[model samples]
Target: MANHKSAIKKIRSDERKRLRNRYQHKTARTHIKKLLTTKDKEEAQLLLKVVHGMIDKLTKKNIIHKNNAARKKSRLAKYVNKLVATA
Candidate 1:
């Protein structure tokens, strides 16, 4: 219950941003999981490209930590490479 009009508007904007960020983060996680589960190297590689881009963007926006982004990318890359090598 914001008493001031500006304060109310700020709260509304914050809520909107929060929801948008949450959506993006969730999407990123879902895509990462999908990539991990994918057995097809080609498809998974494509998905990894997109996922990596999403992670980089999130890192740039400070939605996730830089180290977190790096770690995720590293692990995913390793998994994807293993799939590629085995295929």
Candidate 2:
């Protein structure tokens, strides 16, 4: 469907970027879910750090909005804090 060579290349590159972004987003969500289910405060804290980094990277890449990333990080921190308080 692409008429120009540059347009064809762009399509290919876009597809690759899309797949990469999807993978990163899915990985971050998986980590977040694991963190939420974890009962150990120490382990959750570690996971929070990792998840935060992933979220920051997603924001940096424009895969997710900055506000969305901030909200996610905030909620995760709150959850971890609650876990710490409970245990």
Query: Model 2 off-target regions past 4 Å?
Result: 85-87
lDDT of each: 0.93, 0.94
Model 1 TM-score, 2 decimals: 0.91
Model 2 Cα lDDT, one tens digit per residue, 1-87: 999999999999999999999999999999999999999999888889999999999999999999999999999999999885344
Q: Any idea what lDDT model 1 has?
A: 0.93
Residue pairs with colliding backbones in model 1 are none
Q: At residue 31, what lDDT does model 1 achieve?
A: 96
* Model 1 lDDT tens row, 1-87: 889999999999999999999999999999999998999888888999999999999999899999999999999999998885334
The CA-based lDDT of model 2 is what? 0.94
TM-score of each: 0.91, 0.95
Candidate 1 deviant stretches above 4 angstroms: 85-87
